[model samples]
Target: MGNSSSLHLQQEDVQAIQDETGFTPQQIERLYSRFSSLDKAGKSHLTREDFLRIPELAINPLGDRIVHAFFYESKNGEEDKVDFKDFVRVLAHFRPIKKNQEKNKLNTRMEKLHFAFRMYDIDGDDKISKEELLAVLTMMVGQNICPEQLLSIAERTIIEADTDRDNLISFEEFAKVLERTDVEQKMSIRFLS
Candidate 1:
């Protein structure tokens, strides 16, 4: 029947998204609509400036770093444009979903932590050095933070998260930070808001 064929096509489309993004139909549809709105002109892609206009992004403490990561660090070769696929891939980590959490507890937490780690890493070195954290905190507070104050803040953050005292925050250390109840709650509120 034609109806059955159309249903089959719909199912296939969902499956394709799942295969590509590791998200289900519901998440894909919900986030796809959200991403599509960022295009503004219905162009099916977002320029760097367009991506920054996302309301949540505009107000986020890590807005500049996040925008930089999504637009420049990912290096998908699109060059100043994030297509629908890029949006989905990046947000798949940041956007929390109950169903996904239920399926993989470790994965959900790791993904969230990984997003944070990537934001602070800045140099893709798989570790957050003092310079990286300083840069991030400096950006968050603007240039008003004096060099001494910024260094102290960065050192304190590293000391708290760097369990092994390796002078860097590894993913394990970063995950521990995410696991703290207060930090986790704040993260949920920040992103899910």
Candidate 2:
């Protein structure tokens, strides 16, 4: 009887996650299996080191920033860790927005842009300063471009994106700059059905 109740609870949890994240039961189960595999210490939460251990993320130019995004909401000196729910929520941001999805849904273009914006807004100031832009650019192309050329490119990008001339790129300015971009396509990830 206890085992049956436990199984029922697990089903409830999966259903809740499906409703919240727009992921099917199979996908959630598959992700749960992957997450469990990644939880090396069996702590039920993943630390920075655990995520960095993934070779693909380790090689990505924005790897650190992407990992940081998972822990961005931590406060009060809390240890940086991502549990199953948080993991699912963050991955949901990368799910392709369905044609029938509401504009207010989490996978919408605005949410995806917001996620990308946060990647560059390292300081959480709600604006991407020139220094922040340069830092991200350096991380992305530091090996390929000289420092001076990278600075020039960052400057040019800011000038073109800073519609208000405030010397910073606000979310509105960032969205405007990407107004014609296929963000829905570029930011999406294909999840197994």
Candidate 3:
């Protein structure tokens, strides 16, 4: 039905990639010489071996397209040598745009994190404390609750939501954690109220 199959990231895999991209995982993972594959770890990263693996193929976009074309041909009992140089050119074209998009994505992530800290700094303290955590957790839990539940809830809220090691939960960390669990249309109303 289709010329080629596409590899999609699972929800957990997507989260891992996003988190890794946010932190140092992407670079660190590569050092182990393990590859990041579309399906898992089967396909290795681009190195001399992978580059040379394709005999006649170039490592650019045209090459990439040609490879796919060749693959389709092969699957149907046909074979052709793809130009490696042209494939390299295709990859070169994609490189710049990919880098730009990644940068934009990183910037957007930072902005959201910055905004969360701003909103939670109700007293302009620049640091979220136990009291602040309690106040918000109380609201999310509702107005009428017991003291014991409140204490446990308050503690859990701060412990689970706090991401950075500063003993305070920054807005960005909280937002990221919440994002993993739930999505609200008006996050501001919930946070502000």
Residues 45-125 of candidate 1 have per-residue lDDT tens digits of 788789778787798778878887676534368767887667666655544444434423322566667767888889888
- lDDT for model 1 comes to 0.69
- Model 3 alpha-carbon drift over 4 Å, by segment: 1-119, 139-143, 181-193
Give the candidate number with the greatest lDDT: 2
In model 1, how large is the Cα lDDT of residue 40? 82
Across 26-120, the per-residue lDDT of candidate 2 in tens digits comes to 77877877888899898878999999998989999999999998887433244588888788888888887777764435677888999999999
Backbone clash count for every predicted candidate, in the order shown: 0, 0, 16
What is the Cα-based TM-score of model 2? 0.89
Angstrom error of the Cα, residue 94, model 2: value is 0.8
| Model 3, residue 113: C-alpha shift (Å) | 6.4
Q: What is the C-alpha lDDT of each candidate?
A: 0.69, 0.83, 0.41
**Better candidate by lDDT, 1 or 3:** 1
Measured with C-alpha atoms, the lDDT of residue 28 in candidate 2 is: 80
For residues 1-193, could you state the per-residue lDDT of candidate 3 as single tens digits? Answer: 1111112334454345435333222322332222232213253223333444554545342334333432322222323322222222222221222233443332343443443454445455666777766665554455578767887876777788777766677666667676763222222121101
